[model samples]
Target: MRIRIGGEVHHGDAVDLRGVDADATAVRETLDLAADDPLATVSATPPALSVALAAAARERGHDHPNDAEIERLRAALATTEPPDSSDPAVDLATARRRAAEAGSDVARLRERVATLRGRLRERRGGDAEPGTSAGEAESLAEVESAFEAATRALTEAETERVAARQALSRATERARRARDASERERSRRDALANRRREARAALARELWDEFWTAFDAVAADAPATDHVGDDPTAFDGDPVAGHAAAVRLARRDDPVVVSAPLFDDEAAATVRDRLRAPVVLVSAP
Candidate 1:
C-alpha cells in the first residue's frame, strides 16, 4: 500500500496520471483528449491503475462501459443538452478558468525542472558552470571561446543536458554503493551483537554454577561466624584445600575477591529453608 517514488532521472520527460482514480468513462474521455490535444502529455496508461479505476467505478454503482459507449457518455458529460453559448462573458470566464489551470500546470512543471537542475548541480559540486570558477566570469568567456575553437563542440543546450545526465548517473551510483555498504555494516554489527549476547549468557551460567558449588563445600566444614569472618586467622584444623577449591571455583568469571566472605552455614541453612539443593560442585579447576 506504500508508494514511494524517487531516484535519479536521466530524462526530463514526465507522465502525469493524477486523475486516474476517476471512472472508466471519465478515464476514456481523458485518454481521447490526451491523444488529440497539444497540451496533454500523458504518454502511457498504467494497466494496473486502469483496471483498479474500472473496478472502483463498477463498485460505485456505475457499470464499466465499452470504449464506444464510454466515448458517447463522455460527450454527454462534457457537452450540455442545449448547447448555445451566445454570451461573451460566459465564454471569457471559461477561457480564464482554462488559462489559469494551464498556468498552474506550467508552474508545477517548471518547479519540477528547477528541482532536477538543483540536484544535477549538487552532484557536479560548486556553483560555477562546468569549466569555470566562482570569481572568474571572464575566464568562463574565455573557456567558451576555446570551446568554440574545437572542431566538434556540442550546442549549449545539448552540453548542459549531457552534463545533467552525467551528474544524475554519478549521484545514483554513489547512492547505490552507500546503500549496499550500510546494509553490509548493519549485518556485521548484528552478528557481533548476537555473539556477544551468547557469550555473556554462557559466562553467567558458568559463574552461577561455580558460586553455588563453593558455598556448599565451605558450609560442610565451617561455623557460620568463621565463614563470615572479616579477617579470620587460619584455624588449627581449617582445611586450606577448601579455600583453594573456592579460589579455583571463583576464577572463571574473573570475580574480584575482597575481605568479605560468605556466611556459608547460614547460606546453606537458608537454602535448606527454601527447599533448594545443597549446591552441586563441578570440577572446572
Candidate 2:
C-alpha cells in the first residue's frame, strides 16, 4: 500500500500517477501483487473485478483451479492399471497337473516292481521257471529304475506346484492393493475438485452481489464508472475504474493504487471520502 518514488516513500490507500512516468520501476513494483495478496497496487482494468474476487478467495483459503489444473486432474483420474491374475492362474493349473501325473506314474511303477520281486522270491535258489523267472527278474530291474526316475520327477513337480501356489497368492495380493490404491486416489481427486468448485462458486456469488451494492451506493458521490449494470464476468466497461472500486472494497486494510485518468477532477476527493484508505495522486509523465 506504500508507494516509494524518486527515493521518496508516500503511504496511502490510493495514489496518483501525476507527473511520474508510467513505466517507472517503482510504479511497476507497487502494482504487482501475488494471487493471495490482500493488498494490491494495480491499474484499474476491465478484468479487475475477477482479479479482486480471486484474491479475496485466496485469502479465504479457497482454491480456484484454472483450466490447466482442471485438465491435469482429469488426466490423472483416467488411467488405471492393475496386476494381472490370468497368467498366474494358468501356471498354477499346469503345475498341479504335472504333479499329479508324476505321482501316478511313480505309484504304477512301484507296484509292478513289487509284484516281479515277489515272483522271483518264490523260485529263489532253485532252477528258474524257464518261461517266467528270468523275464520277471529283468522286468523288476527295469521297473525299479523307472520308479526311481518317476520319484525324482514327482519331487520336481511338487516343488513347481509349491512355487505356483506362492505366485498365485502374491498376484492376488498385488491386485487387491492395486484396486484399493486406485479407488482411494479417485476418491481424493473427486473430493478436491468438488471443494474447489463449491468454494469458487460461493465466492463469486457473494462478491458480485457485494460489488453491485457498493457501486450503486457510491454512484452519487463518486466519479462515474462505465459499468453496464451486469455481471462482472460479462463486464464491457473501462477495466480500471469500476472493478478497481470492487477490489478496494473487498478488504478494508489493503491499499489499492489507482490511475488518475480513470476518474474525473473529483477523483482524489471522492477516493478520500468513499474509500477509508488514504490515497496520494500523481500523474504519469
Candidate 3:
C-alpha cells in the first residue's frame, strides 16, 4: 500500500520506517489502522498483558455477543430488583384468621341476645303489660340495653370482616402483577444472553473458515518449519512466520502498521514476500 504522511509519499509492500521520529501515531495519521493485536506482538510487552489481550479481543469484535444489550440488561437487572410477596401473603393469612375470629364472636353475641329475649318473654306471661311493675320494667330495660349493645357489636365485627377480605383481595392482586413483571424481566435478560452466545459462536465459525481459506492461499509462499508442517495450527503458533501469515489473512488492499525493533531485517524481508497485504514498520523516537 502507498501512504502520504506530512508531504512524504511512502510506498512498499512492507516498508520499514527507519528514522528517529517515525511513530505509530504518525503512521495512523497517514493510514487507517485497526486496533493493535498484542498476541502477535513480541516487543516491549505492556505491564497489563491480560487486560491488553482482552481489549484486543474486543477490538476484533467476536468475544462479546451483543455487548451493548448485555450491558444494558445487566444494568437494569442490578437496579430493578424482583418484588417478593412473602410479607403480603403472610398479612393476608393473618387477616383471614382475625376475620374468622370476629365472625365467631358475632355468632356468640347473637346467641346471647336470643337467650335474653326468651327470658324477657317468660317474665311477661299472661297478656299483662310487659314491664308494669318497677322491678319488671327495670329488668326489661336492662334486656333492651343488652340487645342494642349486642347488635352494635355484631355490626362492627361484620364490617371488620368485610374490610379484611377486601384488603386481602387487593394485596393478592398486587402480588400477581408483581410476579408477572418479574417474569418478563427475566425473560428479556435470558433472550439477550442466548442471542449473544449464538452470535459469538457464529463469528468464531466465520473466522475459522476465513483463516483456513487464507492459509491455503498463502501456504506456497510460507516456508515450512520442521515442527510446523502441513498442520495449520503449528503455522499459526510461529511468532515471526505467524505474524506474516496474519498479514496475509488481513485485507489485501489496506496497509497495517507495526512498531519497528520487533522484526529482524532478514526475517521481515522474507515475511514480506509471504504476505498478501502491505505493512509499515514505524520506529519510536
Candidate 4:
C-alpha cells in the first residue's frame, strides 16, 4: 500500500484482507502503534494529515481520543527510553532531590502559618505564645484551644477595665457633690452673719436718735439760759426710754434737775458742775 506519513512518502508491503475483519480494537491498536513510532509525525495545525487519520479512526468506531488515551500518548511522546534499573546511584540522587523539594515546601508552609499567627496575636493584643506547651502546634485542635483561651482572657481584661472606669466616674461625681454642698453651706453662713451685723447697726442708730431727742427737750424746758446746762447728749441707757422720761420731767415747769446714767461721764460731769444740777454718771455693764 502507498501512504503519505507526515511530509514523507512510504511504500509498505501489501497484505491480503479478503476475509480480515477490521474491528474497533484492531484499528485502536494500529493507531497507538503508529503514534508511538519515532518516525511517525502528526501535525497539530488545521487541514493537516492528522485530520485524515482521525476520520479513518472514526470510521473504525474509534471516534475521538479520551483523557486516558491523551495522557498515554503524552507519556509515550515525552520518553524515548525506559529508566535504567541497574544504576542505584542515579536513583538515590533523584530520591534525595525529591526529598529536598518536599522539605522546602514544608518549610514554606510553616513560615506562612507563623506569619498568620503573629497577625492574629497583634489583632487580639495578646502577649501569649501562638502555639501550645510543646512550642509548635502539632494539630489544628491545639491551635484552636489556645485561641479560645486568649479570647476568654481578653474578654475578662476588657470587662475589668470598664468596671474600673465606672468606679472612677462614680467617685468623681461624689466628690463634686460634696464640694457643691460645702460651698452652699458657707454662702448661707456668710449671709446670716451679714444680716446680724446690719441689725446691730440699725439698733445703734435708733438709740442715738432717741438720746438726742431727749437732750433737746430737756434744754428747752429750762427756765433761764444760765439754768440750762450744756446738753448731756451721751448715755448708756436706751435713748427712746431716756428721752420719754426727760420730756415728762421737763413738762412739770419747775426747776428741773436731770440725773441719768450716761456713757460719757466726763462730759456729763462738766455739764452738771456748770449747771449746778444733779446728774448721774453710770458705767456700762
Best by TM-score: 3
The local distance difference test score of each candidate is: 0.34, 0.55, 0.56, 0.37
TM-score of 3: 0.44
- TM-score, candidate 2, is 0.41
Per residue, candidate 1 scores C-alpha lDDT tens digits across 129-149 of 575555565544444454443
lDDT of 3 by residue, 1-285 (tens): 787765678777777765635667667656755445432332333213223323323445546546777777777778876567366557667766776787787788778878877876776562285537877767777877887787788788778778777776776776677768778787978977776555444443444434545444434444554433332333333343344334455444555555534344434454455555466766533
lDDT of 3 at 8: 77
Candidate 2 C-alpha lDDT tens digits along 72-149: 666666664554545554555665566566556656655655665565455453435455666667765665565566
Separately for all candidates shown, the number of backbone clashes (residues 3 or more apart, or on different chains) is: 0, 14, 0, 0
Highest-scoring model, lDDT: 3
Ranking by lDDT: 3, 2, 4, 1
Q: Rank the candidate models, highest TM-score first.
A: 3, 2, 4, 1
For candidate 1, the per-residue lDDT at 124 reads 45
Off by over 4 Å in 1: 1-154, 213-285
What TM-score does candidate 4 reach?
A: 0.27
lDDT score of model 1?
0.34
